[model samples]
Target: MIAILSDIHGNLPALEAVIADARTAGATAFVNLGDSLSGPLWPAETADLLMREGWPAIAGNHERQVLTHAIERMGASDRFASERLSAAQLAWLAAQPPVLALTDEIFLCHGSPRSDLEHLLHTVEAAGIRQATEAEIAERLGDTPAALTLCGHTHLPRTVTLADGRTIANPGSVGLQAFHDDHPLPYIVENGDPLARYALVRGTGVELRAVAYDHLGAAAKAAREGRADWAAALRTGLAG
Candidate 1:
């Protein structure tokens, strides 16, 4: 089985827990959908850990912003990550592609095939965040000849099967669980429980897994970094 992880956002405790869980589940390969080292907690340490493994990864919007844009061109979170990461870490982020065609049947991307910033499986309709229709997701995916596409950016566990039998899965976040974004749109995303999230995929089957961890410690780390918002999210998994 392959373990899929994303949006780690520098929380080392959560990442450690998720890795242990996936490993115990007999996952032999690890794929990290990026936005890995873009938070206040442990970007440097997390980067070092992941780099040692050299797991395959795709770049997320935060990774792109950190590598390609100046700190002045980034938002608060991106700026925070970029400012503290080592030069080698920045280079590693720069080396990742927006998409990875792992095999003829399997693919990996941070968000969508075309843009790492687009949510291929989600949309804001009315007042609620909803999963996109099969057609909508297929349209966003374009002509990628993949039966299973793995993506993460939303930090929500999701699985969508298109009419053509294409499956897309977001394993959720390994670190941060709840967050609010207001760049291209305004929305709040939450999981309501402080647990490390990851995914296991074998064949066409997908499992969204959550691993219990010491969330209070993660919250303390975020708080020490002066990110009270992140601290609250880490602790409660609720929107802060």
Candidate 2:
């Protein structure tokens, strides 16, 4: 079985908890879907841990933006995340691809195969997030023929089946659970708790899992790093 994770966003405690839980749940292999260190908790430390594990990962929109976008074009959070990384870590992150194929049956990408910034299965409505129609999602998927396509960017756990029976999974965020983003549109992502999220795929089935960790500890780390917003998000999984 393989544990697929995404949007870890530098919360080492949360990532550790999710990995431990996945191990206990019989996952032997791991794939990361990116946005691994774009938060205030511990970008370099998180990257080092993942590097030590040698898990293959793709680049999320955050990763692309942080690496390629000019500093003047970056948001406050992006600037904050970029400043905390070492030159070596930055180089490593810049090297990750936006899309990867693990096998004939599995393909991994941050947001979608077409664009790292587009949501494959979600539309940002005024009320909140709405699941895109099957055709809409399939259009976003384009010509990829992988049976299972994994993506993450919105930090929400999701699974969708296209009309052709292909499955798309958003394993969700492993670290930061709640936040506001303004890239493609203004939207908020919250899971109602500061729990690490990932997914395990075995045989032909997928199981989304949330692993609770030391939220206060992560919050403390964020506070120490001068990110009160992150501290608050860690304490309460809300954009407020």
Per-candidate total of colliding backbone pairs: 0, 0
Give the per-residue lDDT of model 2 (tens digit) for 1-240.
999999898889999999999999999999999988877778878988988898888888878888988989987667777888888888888888889989999999888898888888788777767777888889999999999999998888989987788999998889888887765667787788888889999954789998889999999988897888888888888777
lDDT tens string, model 1, 1-64? 9999999998898899998999998999999998998887888898899999999988898888
lDDT against the true structure, per candidate, is 0.89, 0.86
**Model 2: lDDT of residue 73:** 92
| Candidate 2, poorest ten consecutive residues by summed lDDT | 181-190
TM-score of 1: 0.96
Task: Find the 10 residues in a row with the least total lDDT in model 1.
Answer: 123-132
> Which residue runs of candidate 2 sit more than 4 Å off their true CA positions?
none
For model 2, what is the alpha-carbon lDDT of residue 176?
A: 84
lDDT of 1: 0.89
Instruction: Tell me, by TM-score, which candidate is best.
Output: 1
Residue 39, model 1, lDDT: 81
